[model samples]
Target: MLRRTLLCTGAAAITAVFTGSLWHGAAEVRPGPGRYGPLKVPDTNGLALPDGFTSRLIARTGHKVGGLTWHAAPDGGACFPDGEGWIYVSNCEVPLLGGASAVRFGKDGSIRDAYRILSGANLNCAGGATPWRTWLSCEEIARGRIFECDPYGERSARPRLAMGRFKHEAAACDPDREVVYLTEDEPDGCFYRFRPGDWGDLTEGTLEVMCGAGERVIWKPVPSPAALPRPTRHQVKEARHFDGGEGCYYADGVCYFTTKGDNRVWAYDAASATLGVAYDADSPLTGVDNITGAPTGDLYVAEDGGNMEINLIAPDRSVSPFLRLDGHGRSEITGPAFSPDGKRLYFSSQRGRSGKPTDGHTFEVTGPFRNLVPPQRA
Candidate 1:
């Protein structure tokens, strides 16, 4: 019940290209009038939002946002709460053994049950949500890694692998400085950080890689964290290579990320540790998959297929769309989490519209976002 949007004017001055092969930087931040601005006219029936935003069909692909049932290809998700209800946990890309599933909304989002929190593991897809709340399911292949669920279904999700094993594709955590950023979908991807010798422990850690050296960026150290025949992005040749990453977020100290071959949207800066590409590729937005960090700091990405729409970006990188997707068609829109009271935004339309494969769906877009805090850097 808060959609008046119409202020628009901020974000747009990017030059980014630090792995596009060497120098080029301008990590500015001008996200003014944004909190969902000047853009709203689609949502024909399911996702085309903006006129005060709206969407609710929370859980499909078999139906049952809860009570178990909804499971089939709905990629990446995270939301946990209980005692008044809330527990999303999606991510089940399927293929050989895929895994991750859960549901049980009810603070008005309805649905009261749906299960399967982590299966055999294999294509799973995006993940991230843990300050100690938990929900880290990844596994995109090439021996992917990461799995730490416990969204109320209890525990036993295992698979930490010290947090290194290529192909993953989504993860976030800056919990003040416990560090844990990761994203890699191939095309030679690479952008990680683990360092968990303790403090909330994630089994163990050390997997560096972010190297750059010119405008400053270092953390290199991954001489085969288990590439075996070699293949952790060729065992990291100094780092800085992402055009296939597909989603990341580390908040506060900043670490946003997204790289679907080149639809870019990056931002490192753990206090000028420098690395910026805050939305480039000309910028009309394209297949940038996953990504979520909005209470107002702006950022929403998630497209994975070009016109499935969902681009939000702001904070001066200015981008729009915020919603679009005509009848499914090509399918793509994975995860996009938000809702620890950030006002509800969870996403997924992954493969529905009769593209069958069990179909796909998982929505809930409430309204008036903008509660975003934590952004006082210098």
Candidate 2:
């Protein structure tokens, strides 16, 4: 039941002209798959899924047919609702191979459309979805920029260079305040915020670097694109030296961001403009990547390194193993996004020693968050 409306050439031009204020129309509400619970994957490279969970090949690398090229290596992703189907915007981290592009998949698991969103950007890592229904794909390499891709349109995509380009990892937006928060992938990277002058426009915004400590630390602020010199780390060299900020999410008047190298999640209060450690694992075995809030207020963290498993940090500071790779070595799991209905979870795992294709694959697991055997209680 997937439906696609092809825009006429004239209509497409008009849409691009009005892209800045495109939020005027009502956003369509989409439904989710009715079923829920753990999925089943017959072949996990000796890995294991939850009891009933299942895994199937949605797409793969080098499996070309016609003009459509397979995804070389999939990275960050965001699922956008489109008619009866869903537009799964995925990031292809390959650069030299030249197959990296944003691919859209239908609800029935068919390639609806695909486009090269960002060219010459290497390691297009993880990014967040904006309230305006766009995917912000980040580049992990030095001097990387964030690009906003409208999966609904074939040619309405562009890079948002006003967001203070750096080794961009992930970004989150506050729809009510029209503020966008971004994370740097550098070891000493500093957190950033962009306050757009216009609610619907992002090109003209006030960029600032976070400074100070706790409540005292404020978004000291920086020059806008017009006044600022060439965007480089040297201009804000003092902001460097972070523990490695990656995943970010905006919810409940706060921005929850994570540091993958240090395994810590910090909450920045939008009202007070202060950052504090929200969650940290007791052991150093967990390396976190993209993080998303569950419908019930729990936070799900995707593990990029260390042991292969998704960790759930409950409200009461109780951390438990939600999903385990169930094999040997690291799993390199990325993007842990929840379905709109919050019944199912979607994630991607890069190539491991199990010969599961270095190109990476997306997996879906269903089930309510439940307790597993604790990690031996310290």
Candidate 3:
């Protein structure tokens, strides 16, 4: 039941950073352009955007986009190019019924087709896009795992058990180091990286947990990736504890991730083995969740609670609001992926105005994206 769309090939090295004061109490008021200007006001769709941007509802829970029904509780998402058009894959965050769906778009930003990419997965929360043109659909349960999905819908999705099974939150593939970084959503979750036996194969690999704090960190092998004797997080006693790991993304030479419990965004330099904070409560952004990078080197972070805004952290490290959802205070934003051309962005209001999973709403924002800027090596 899959529609054919020509798959386009490309590579992206998007990354972002922050270098401002730190705080833990409340969001601090900082001065920055926000790249775009001050948001005008909420439009008919209850969305506030910059001058040249406009928003449109793409799909809703139990609703049909193209010909297939959209998934519920849409969470992590990523964009994949298809010829001149593109495809956006969104995860379903509902257990048992939680899987993922894909919406195919034409070059003119029109919906061409929609279909299911993965099914029977439990609580597929947040996942990453692979360099080999696959989507990593991660489950958010105690023994959850990552499923490699074909965006083209030609192949069946497969579970990569080697990637470790432990309350998986998100996955980001670091092409430079040939390692896939992952996050867990537990109070004392551990940051992990998996090095596949082969560069593009996930069947066999060494699962290692990050251990250390401050500037430099190290990775220790997890004796049991399957968490047989104990939970994966507990297997590595020396692993650095990350409170509630959420979204994860890789760009340039760094891996960026968020810890919702701590309200902090972290940057890990693959080359130097260094770790640093990219954003904290000191900035305006809060309830940091799914993260994605822009062509201009800005990292867009969606909020799980605070203000229902998607904040942007520029390469210069300044924090500012990119977009905010009004009348949706009860809902949180999930997914924040940019179209392959960087001209459009897609995200979802997990609960929409009603704050119910069945009321989930996905939207698209079209605007002029500034020129691309490669982030300075961290």
Evaluated with lDDT, which candidate comes out highest? 3
TM-score of each: 0.35, 0.76, 0.90
Decoy 2 TM-score against native: 0.76
lDDT of each: 0.73, 0.61, 0.85
Superposition error at 111 for model 3 (Å): 0.6
- In every candidate, how many clashes are there? 12, 12, 0
lDDT of 3 by residue, 1-378 (tens): 112111111121122222222211222234477889888889998999999999999999888899998888999999998999999999999979888899999999999999999999999999999888999999999989899999889999999999998999999999878999999999999999999999989999999999975466799999999989799999877899999999998876778899999788887778778676667654568799999987667789999989899998776556788999998888899989988878888999998999998889999998877864333444
Model 2: residues with Cα > 4 Å off, grouped in runs: 1-53, 64-68, 96-120, 224-241, 327-331, 354-357, 368-378
**For residues 1-378, could you state the per-residue lDDT of candidate 2 as single tens digits?**
212111112223112111111111222111221122242453454334555544444545555522456565677776666765565566766654321355455555566676555556567788888777877788776667777776565556577778776778888987756788888877777788888888666767787787753333566566543224544434554453458888898766777888977777776666655455555544322787778876455567777766676666555444555566644254477767765544456666755445344556666665543332112212
Residues 345-366 of candidate 1: C-alpha lDDT, one tens digit per residue: 8888878777665888878888
In Å, residue 314's CA in model 1 sits off its true spot by 7.8
Q: Is candidate 1 or candidate 3 better by TM-score?
A: 3
Residue 46 lDDT in model 1?
A: 54
Instruction: Identify the leading candidate in terms of TM-score.
Output: 3
Winner on lDDT (2 vs 3): 3
Residue 173, model 3: lDDT of 94
Ranking by lDDT: 3, 1, 2
TM-score of 1: 0.35
